[model samples]
Every structure is written in C-alpha cells, then in structure tokens.
Target chain A: MDLFIQLTLTGLTNGAILAMAALGFVLIFKASDVINFAQGEFLLIGAYVTFAMLAQLGLHWTLGLLLTLGVAVALGVAVERLVLRPMIGEPIISVIMVTIGLSSLLKALVSAIWGNQPKAFPPFIPSQPVKILGATVGEDRLWAIVIAIFMLGIFSVFFRRSREGIAMRAVADDQQAALSMGISVKKIFAWAWSIAAATAAIGGALVANIVGVGPELAGFGLRVFPVVILGGLDSIPGAIIGGVVIGLLEAYTGGYIGQGLNQVLPFIVLILILMIRPYGLFGQEIIERV
Target chain B: MLTLNNIEVIYNEVILVLKGMSLQVPEGKIVGLLGSNGAGKSTTLKAISGLLKPEDGEVTDGSIKFMGEAIHHKDAAEIVRMGIFQVMEGRRVFEHLTAEENLLAGGYTRRERDLSSDLEMVYSYFPRLKERRHQTAGYLSGGEQQMLAIGRALMAQPRLMLLDEPSLGLAPMLVLEIFGIIKRINQEQGTTILLVEQNANLTLGVADYAYIMENGRIVLEGYPEDLRQNADVREFYLGLTEVGQRKSYRDVKHYKRRKRWLS
Candidate 1:
C-alpha cells in the first residue's frame, strides 16, 4: 500500500507535466491539422531560453519566465510566416515532412547555442519534501500538478467561451466557411502556434527543474504521442486524462512489472486503442450522411 | 452596393471559369442571378466577395467594386470587415461547433458590438436555431442547418449579403419558409443581396431584378416580370409549350431544350 501510494503520487506529477506538453501538441493539431513533429523541440527550446534568462543572465524568475514566453511567441509567429505559411495547399504528407525537418533544425539550433552537455536548472520552486495522503513528495511536484491542472482548466474555458477560441475552432471546422464569415485563418494559425509554443515552454521549464536541462528533454515530445493518441489528438481534456492514465500506468508497471517494461507498455496500449477506438475516448468523429 | 465589371476569373491560371462576367447589385434590393450548374453563378459571387484566391482561382482581368471602392484585390476577411458576407452552398456550418457558437463566429469581424442581441435577432428570424443553438451543428437536420447558416450570416450584420444556392437541397415547404425569411430579411434590414440560384421560379418570386447566366457570362437579364413574358423563358423555365398550346403529360427536362441566348 505504501509503495502503491508512492507510485501514484509520482505518476500524478509526471502525468501533469506530460499533460502540459500534450496540450500544446493537441492545440496545433486541432487548429491547423498539422501533426507537429517539432513539438518536442519547442519544449527543448523553452527550457534553454528560460535557463539563459534565469541562470546565465541571473534575471528574476518572473521576468525570465515572461521573457521566455515572449521569445516563444516570436518563434511561433516567425515559424508560421516563414516556414508553414508558404507550404499552404501543399500535400499533407509534404507538410508533415517539413515539420519533421523542422524538428531537426530546432534541435540543431539548441545544441549550437547551448551545447550538448546537460546543465543544472536554476532553482525556482522549492523541492522540499511534502506529504500528501501518507505519500511523501517534493513541493515542486505538487506545484507541477496544481499548475498543469490550472492551465488545462483555463484552456478548456478559453476554447468554449472566448471569441478568439471559437474563431479558431470555426477555422478548424471549415476554412472556406470560416473565411466567408471574415475569420482571419492566418491569424488563427499564428495564435495556435504561439499558444502551443508558450505552453510547451512552461512544461519544459517544469521538467527541467526536475531532471535538469538537456537535449533528452526533447524526448518528451515522443512520449506525448501515446498520450495524445490515447486521449484524442484534437481534444484538450483528452490530453489531461490521457496524461494521468498513461502516467499512472507507467508508474505501476515500473514499480511492479520490472525495468524498461513501462516504456514499452504505453505503446502496446496505444496500439490496442488505435485498433479499437481509433478516435480515442473523447475525439470527435466526423459524421457524414449519405 | 456591389458591381462586377466584366470580371475574368481563371482557376490555376489556365481554366477560365468566369469570362468577363458583369453584373450589379444595387443597395437595398434582392437581385437574382439564375444559372444552370457550371454557369459560373457561384464563381461570380466568389469573385465579388474575394473568395477565389484560396481555391487557386484569381480575377485575372476586370474589377469588382463594392460601395464605390474597387475591392477585387482585397482578401475575404478585409472584404467582410467592409460588410460583405457570403452564405456558401451546402450550408457549411462548423460541424463540431454548437449552433450558437457558429453564429458567434459570424460576428468575428466587428469587435465592439453586443453579440447577445445579435444572437437574439438571429433567433427571432430562426427560432428553430435558438432551440438547437446548443446542439452540435453537424448532427442537425438539413433544413435546420440551412436555418443556422442564414442565422449565422445575420450575426455578421453585413450590408451586402451574397447568398450562393440557398435552396440547394431542402424540402419544398422548408425552401419556401427559408425564402420567405430571406425576403423578410431583405425588406426589414434594407440590406443589398445578390442571390445566386438554379431555381428560377422561386428566385423570380423574391427578386427585384434578375440575370440569367450561362458558361461564365450573362446571357440575358431583365425584370422578373419582363423575363417571364419572354418566349424562351416561358418554354424553358415555366415549361409552357406556347400560348394556348396543348401541354404534354410528361414535363420535359429544360436541359433538353437549347438555350436560345447560348446558341
């Protein structure tokens, strides 16, 4: 029971961070139908930029975070304008290929600037051990869970009630129809990219605090695919639930089943889900009448 | 309020869809543009509303003027901000969005206005939409989706509303209901309308003036009453054999008869 509690708490913290990264991936997919291969790179870039602001420059944590987000926004807009916009009307496979190429480019840029060696992340949140439900965990882990949940809740409301959010969904539904209604499809794409980058950066920074900043952090993007596929690629709530579910499963498997099995289990489950419920638990299936 | 002056539209720079198509939609009037399928009626509306560029279609020659400003080069969003909205064919309501959200999306161009009142106004026109406002639009019945599409257009509060094939697929009764509401919208709001349709009888019933297009050009145009008296219109559209001539039990398809203007 003690082991179970420990595993569950740790799983929750990891899941929360996974949910944050997956949320950004889902956002880009929902708004632009582009399965972003560079999603992991966004997280990597975010961590390094925040590291530079906080550790190298020794800026205030708040200032560093804000500056990091600003950089993210600019990066997103520039990428949209320079890289993705020109590729509009190109084949879906070609667009996907470009994103794959983009992932490599972003990874290279990070290594060029920050080097390949791992760096210790600047301390922002306290890592003091705290007890919840008889399970001891770090204060930072608790904070991660709280912050991730809060951000997810805010995004859910934004997509539902906000005008900009509705516009984005409208564009997703039918670009031509949305254009007819005067929604700037281009602007929506920029917004999607920016928000996706900003959220991924936050997730990256949190993960950096836990594991330290390194190129390996980019691997979180690969881990997110199963989460998104399990949840639903176009679903925000799916990301959260999928994150926690996968997180818990991984923890339980690692604790009980043995080494390296946890990494392989999620993919096995992902394949099963794909074969059964292809749209995932909460994915919207396009219903067309004959 | 809208004028297409000998506009030439080419798709992918080769396939010419609209060849010098000229038409005018005066303010506060419903002008019916009647055409058969592939007659460029939709393209003309697209050209006027600047929706062609997205389809790799371009206005290679001529000009489209809206409110006395040449707007052929402007993008769809910019043209919409200047108060022109197109209710496209197939009632392309956002399938995943609720009916109310679809309506809110229409009011996207104008920022500083009460959308709730606009929603109320749309509900008044389409009470059915109000009932189904919370329902996802993709699941709505065809007639209901049609109403939602029109209600969405109302939310935009556009001055020149370009309606493309409003009667595409619907029950006769529902089509009549929709047309009645459309006429009411035109009269009450005093908004200029360019209505493109294949249904000549119903279009003539609602239009103040009408144009008949074929193969990307206006073949003939006149007041609906005048066109009704034309022999070609009588035989082809109304299925009249001749004045006091014997009528056959079989209603011959209009396509079987050659268009006098086209020939």
Candidate 2:
C-alpha cells in the first residue's frame, strides 16, 4: 500500500509534466490545423535557455524561468512567420513533413550548441520534502504539479473570456470565414505558435527541476501525444483529465503490475481511444465533403 | 446598379463553366438569373464576388461597372466593403459561433461606431435570431440557418444583394417566407438584388426582370409577364407549354443570337 501510494504520487508529478507539454501542442493544432512535430524541440530549447540563465548568467531561478518563457514565445512567433506562413495551404502531408524536419533541425542545433550532456536545474522551490497522506514527495515535484494546474487554469480563462481566444476558435472552425470577417488568420496562427512555445518552455523548465535537464527533454514533446490524444486534440479540459489518468496508470503499472505495459500504456490507451472515438474525448468530429 | 459583361470562367483551363455571361441589375430592382445545375449561375456570382479569377475571362472584353465604376478588378472583400454582399447558396454561416457572433462577423466592413445600430436592425428583420443569439449556428434548423445567413449579409448593409438559391433545401413554406422577405427587403430597403435560382417557378414569380440561362449562355430575357406569355418559352422553358398553345410574346434573344442563321 505504501509503495502504491508513493508510485501514484510520483506518477501524478510526471503526468503534470506531460500535461504542460500537451497544452502547447493543442494550442498550435487548434489555431492553425498544423501538427507541430517540433513541439518537443521547443521544450528542450526552453530547458537549456532556463539552465543557462540560472547557472551561467547567475540570474535567480524564478527570473530565469520567466526569461526562458519569453524567449520560447519569441521563438514560436519567429517559427510561424519564417517557417509555417510560407507553407500555408500546402498539402497537409507536406506541412506535417515540414514540422518533423524542423524538429530534426532544432535537435541538431541544440546538440551542436549544448552538447549531449545532462545538467542540473536548480529548483525554484525550496530543497525540502513534503509528506502527504503517508507518502513522501519532493517540494519541486509538488511545485510542478501545482504550477501545471495553475497554467492550465489560466489558459482556460484565456480561451473562455478573451476576444482573441474566441477569434482563434472561430478561425479553427473555418479559416476562410474567419478571414472574411477580418480576423487576421495569419496573426492568430502566430499567436497560437507563441503561446504553445511559451507553455512548452515552462513545461521544459519544470521537468528540468524534477529530473536532470538534457537533450532527452525533447522526448517529453513526443510523450505528450498520448495525453493529447486521450484528452481530445482540441480540448483544454481534456488535456488535464487525460494527463491525470495517464499519470495514475503509469504509476500503478510501474509499481504493482510491473512488466512492459507501463512503458507502452499511454500508446495503448491512445490507440483504443482513437479506434473508438477517432476524434478522442473532446475532439470535434468533422464530416468531410468528398 | 451592377453590370457583368462577357465574364468567362473555366474551372481547370478545360472545364468551361461560365462562357461569356453578361448581366445587369438596375438600382433597387429585383433581377433573376435562372439556370439549371451546370449552367454556371453560382459561378457567375462567384466571379462577380471575386472568388475565382478568369484565366480566359476578362471584364474588359465585357466589363462589370458598379455605380459607374469598373468593379471587376476589385477583390471579393473589397467588393463586399463596397456594399455588395452574397448570401451564398448553402447558407455558409460560421457553424461554431453563436447566432449573434455570426451576425457580428457579418458587419466586418462596418464602422465600429455603427455596429450597435446595425445589430439592432438585423434583429428587427429576424427576431427569432435575437432569441437564439447565444445558440451556436450549427444547432439552428435548415430554415433558421438560411435566415441567419441573410441576416448576417444584411448586417453588411449592402446596396446590392446577390442571393444564390435562397430557396434551396428549404421546405415549401420556408421558401415562400424567404421570397416574401426578399421582396420586403427590396421594397423597404430599396436595395437592388441579383437573385440566382435553379427553381424557375420561384424566380419568375419574384423577379421584375428574368433571364433564362442554359449551357452557360442567356437563352431568354424579358419582363416576368412577357416571359409568361411567350408560347415557345412557356412550352419548352417555363414548363407551361403542356397546358395549351396560347398566343405569347415574341422571343427576342433567340432571334438575336441566331441572326446569322436566320438571315
């Protein structure tokens, strides 16, 4: 029972990290109908930037985190304008290929600059452990969970209340109509990319504090796919729920069930969900014309 | 006032859709362009709305002069801003937006200062839309979606309205109601209208002047009363010839287009 409890808490912490990365993917997909394969690279870049700020520049951890997010947001905007915009209305396969190619490029660039070594990220939270319901968890882990939940909440409000958010939703529904209504579809695409990049940066930073930062940070971007698929690609609430469910499953399986199911559990869930409801839990089912 | 002179449009450089189609709608009159499925009625409207550029079609060969200016060169959104609004055949309302949001988007070209009044006027036209203003457009019934599309177009405050098959997919009652509203808009707002319809019965009933198009060419043109009285038009075109042979107005375009063959 103690082992189960410990595993569950740890799983939840990891799930929170997955949710953060998934949020960025959802934003870009929703606004531009572009699957950003480079989303993972954004996370990796963000963590390195944060590490450099804190360790090399001697900035405070909190300040470093903020600066890292700002940089990520800028990177997102630059990518939209430079990479995504030129490929507008291109074949979906071509667009997907572009993003995958971009991911490879970013991974190579990161390795060239930072080398293939892991670095410690100083935790913004105090270096202490907390006991919760007889299970011990690190303060940084708890902070990761809390911060992830908070960011998701903030994003929900942005989607529900902000005019720009509604405009983005409108564009997602019908790009031509949205453009006809004078909503600059290009601007919405840029904003979506920026927000997604910013979220990935924060996710990267949080993961670095919990685990050592490395090129492997890019893996989290791909890891988010299961959560996003489970949650529904377009659903914000689904992302949170999907994240928690996957987290708990991973924890329980690793601790009790054992074997390899834990490693492939998310993929299994994603496949099942997709087969049953191709749009996932919250995805809008579209009827194609031809 | 709007005019389309010899606007030719080919879909893929091979499929000739609109072949030298020309039309004119005088200020504040309801003109009807009647045609069958492949006759290019919708394509003609699309050409005027700037959705498709003619590779082999040019306004100079036949020009589109709107309010005495060449508007064929203008963009669709620009033409919309110039007060030409199209209620596309399928009632393509933004499906995800609430009814009111759809209406708000319609007024995209309006000044921010004039939006509130425009909103009120649209509500006055379709009070049902006001009641369901918060409901997403997808949930609206077929008839309601058509109403919302028209109301949205009205929000643009167009001087000339291009209505493409407002009766399509609608029940008989809704079709009649729609035609009634079209007449009311013309009578009350004094807006000129170029209506395209595959339903010839409805077009002839509502139009001040009617043009019968077949194979992307205008085969007949006249006042509604004159077209109704024509013997050959009534028989072969209007589906009225089966009733009986009656003395009717003479065919003009048939005579004109076949001048060389006749002479």
* Winner by TM-score: 1
Q: lDDT tens digits, residues A1-290, model 2?
A: 78878988898888888888888899888887778899899999988888888877989877887899889989988998898888877776788899999999999998998899998767766648899889899888888789889988998888765657766877787766555444567788889999999988888887877786899889877778899899989888778778888988988888888858888998899899989987888876673332
The residue-by-residue lDDT of candidate 1 on A1-290, one tens digit each, is 98899999999999999999999999998998889999999999999999999999999999999999999999999989999899987886888899899999999999999999999987788888998778899888888899988998999999999899999999888999999998988999999999999999999888887878999999988999899999999999999999999999999999999869999988998999899989888888977866
Candidate 1 achieves a global lDDT of 0.91
Best by lDDT: 1
What's the TM-score of chain A alone for every prediction?
Answer: 0.98, 0.95
Indicate which candidate wins on DockQ.
1
lDDT of 2 by residue, B101-193 (tens): 788777766766447787788788788888898998888888899999889888888998889899989899989988988899899888889
**Fraction of native contacts under 8 Å reproduced by each candidate:** 0.90, 0.18
Note the Cα lDDT for every prediction shown. 0.91, 0.81
What does candidate 2 score on TM?
Answer: 0.82
TM-score of every prediction relative to native:
0.97, 0.82
After the best TM-score superposition of candidate 1, give how far the Cα of residue B207 lies from its true spot, in angstroms: 0.3
DockQ, each predicted model: 0.87, 0.25
Candidate 2 contains a number of clashing pairs equal to 1
The DockQ-derived docking category for candidate 1 is: high
